[model samples]
Target: MKRTTFSLLVVDDDEDDRMIIDDAFLEIGYAGQVKKFMNGKMLFDYLEQIDPSFYPSLIVLDNTLPKMGAEDILTLLKESPAYQSIPVVVYTTSLSPSRQEKLLQKGVYACYQKGEVMEKVIELAKQLRELAESNSPKE
Candidate 1:
């Protein structure tokens, strides 16, 4: 299999969750950068400051954030052509089918329930890796 280097942005308020995600990715041997933000506001601030070419290959967003929630961020991203192409995957602990449908309608790449087990997290990391690799620009 070909290896691709890409950047992933994670927006979640929970410190433990972020650390777990980082560990999971590391355990999976993902050869990429993972930039994490505490909330959507921080994410937007980073986005504004970075060059467009350096935008993250994927954004893993938690539905419940401190300042701005995932729904609001999704709206803003969809409205802006410059950031619309970046795929966003919503990771949340409580998501109803209706909520998932709504998120999908709003243009999220995928919505996954936050898992309790380490194996589940690793699986999510692997899935995210595949999604990021598929969306990454070809050389």
Candidate 2:
């Protein structure tokens, strides 16, 4: 069977981290599209205009954001009937296993702790790609 490419919505405040995520996607040879936002407000504003049916396959968000954090965004998405199905992966530099577990309980698909190493980043990228692809809309 043929596979469909994923569409990812990423929310991060750091330019370098954003670059890393973008580069990771490239390293994994991701075939999907990635849309990035520096803040949650902008992401929400954009999402409001898009059709729910066309929502991205995955959402990769940062724990610390300028306005709304990852938890807030996840809560908002989970509360929305139109967006609840989309998978969310929290990517953060903090190493809080308890927080990660809480996020998982709150409905995020996965939590990945960001690292500086290229190999680790590449591995994370591969995992993200697998997750995004696996959760893509079934034809």
Candidate 3:
């Protein structure tokens, strides 16, 4: 089967983190495209004109951001039927209990500390690629 490149959305305020994620993707030789968004508000606005069928398969979210925090954006995402199918993975430095709890409640598919982000980002890309190629949702 011809593998389709997965589309990943990197929603982070920090430029460096986005670069790291991009590097990780390149390292993995992933057949996936990543769209960078510095803030959720901007991401949301951009999504307005996009077809829901092109919704990203994976969303890498940073815990903290300006203009719009990850939490608020997640809330809005959950409320949108068209955009809710994307699996969100929280990759951030903060692993505080309160933040973790809220993230879990909001249905983050996975959470990883920034220390392990590079490895996890590569893993995430591989897993999503497998899922897409197999035409099945990961269990």
Candidate 4:
């Protein structure tokens, strides 16, 4: 079950990408808090320090992150007892099948290529919302 208000954690270094994600969420009328991190270091720090009960409903991660790459971060998250259940969606410009397979193997919920078109991005956001909602903790 989901909380009354959902929360989202997004890790991306690109300012434009962040804005687009925010806009997409807003456009979809997502009633959630969208936290942004410009680097993997900060994101990791935040994750490690947060109380387990307050973990985000979902994590939207980029394949290429500053400070740490997706593989390392995903590994850490999956290995951690507190964060392994948190769904992670890979949102990146890299559209490699092997890369997607690798992330899927690493336990990512889904992988999506960042879109250049607004409509497509919005659609992705809608899909993400559904994925996150599905994974929400049971109340």
Candidate 5:
């Protein structure tokens, strides 16, 4: 099966989830890069350093990242022009309506529920592929 190329960045402190995403991508033959960051701050800092042209096609932000403050990151990204253009997707098990609203208000592309299993990770990769394809500029 042919797969769409997508550069995805996952922000979550959990090592297992990171590995799960890595494994799921490999299983589905997603050859594009999947960069993992332990927190929002690191991701923000890295994005600052790298050229915006190198931005990931999708960003998966886990709600549980500590110290880096997920909500704050969302708000900040929403305010910045360059960061605001990149699609942000919240990937966390929490399904609170308020949080979801907050993320939407901040302009998230979509949100997914994460859990102990790798099923969510695999599903997310599939969805992200669709997102990348849909958002691609027409020739």
Candidate 6:
């Protein structure tokens, strides 16, 4: 099957993690854009500036951030009519079961623990690529 190109927005405080994710996608030869933000504020700012038609196909959010945590960012996205339909996947180093449930209840598409190995991250990148392609506009 042919794959459709799409854009993904990732918000994570850790620069190394972001680089790893980007590299993983590249390793898979994902034919889409991967934009990274350091925090929720930067993500929101970019969102605000983009045309609605140009909005990202998916958003990957880190559960913990220096300012404006994942929950806050998720709430805002869910509340916004323009952003509500975009899928959000939460990535975290560690999460309690209750917290994961809470994030799901708030409308995140999925929650995944950060992988310890590069291979694991590559697997995650593949999943993310599939999701982005699935969400892409049908031609």
Q: By summed lDDT, which 10 consecutive residues of candidate 4 come out lowest?
A: 1-10
Quote each prediction's TM-score.
0.92, 0.88, 0.78, 0.89, 0.83, 0.92
Model 3: per-residue lDDT, tens digit, 26-126?
Answer: 78776246677899877887678676655666777888888677788888888888877767778788788887887988888777677555677677656
Better of 4 and 5 by lDDT: 4
Best by TM-score: 6
Q: Please report the candidate that would top lDDT against the real structure.
A: 6
Give me the runs in candidate 2 sitting further than 4 Å from their true place. 1-6
* Clash pairs (backbone) in predicted model 2: none
lDDT (tens digit, per residue) of candidate 4 on 1-139? 6543336888999999999988998999983567888877888788778677878888889999866888888999899898888888889998589888999999988889898999999999888888777777878
lDDT of 2 by residue, 1-139 (tens): 5433238888999999988888888877773577788998988887888766667888899998866988899999999988899899998999488888889999988888897897898898788777777877888
**What is the Å distance of residue 134 in model 4 from its true position?**
1.0
Location of the lowest summed lDDT over 10 successive residues in candidate 1:
1-10
Kindly provide the TM-score of model 5 when superposed on the true structure, using C-alpha atoms.
Answer: 0.83
Candidate with more favorable, higher lDDT: 1 or 2: 1
Cα lDDT over the full model 5: 0.75
Which stretches of candidate 3 lie above 4 Å from their native place?
1-6, 116-139
Candidate 1 per-residue lDDT, tens place, 10-109, comes to 8899999999998999998873577888988888898998778777789999999866899999999989999999999999999989999999999998
Q: Which stretches of candidate 1 lie over 4 Å from their true place?
A: 1-6
Error of 5 at 74 (Å): 1.3
Model 6: per-residue lDDT, tens digit, 1-139?
A: 5433237889999999998898899999963588889999999998898778778889999999987999999999999999999999998999999999999999999999899999999999999888977886666
Using TM-score, rank the candidates from best to worst. 6, 1, 4, 2, 5, 3
- At residue 36, candidate 2 shows an lDDT of 82
Clashes found in each candidate (C-alpha, N, C closer than 3 A): 0, 0, 0, 2, 0, 0
lDDT, candidate 3, equals 0.72
For model 4 the local lDDT of residue 17 reads 97
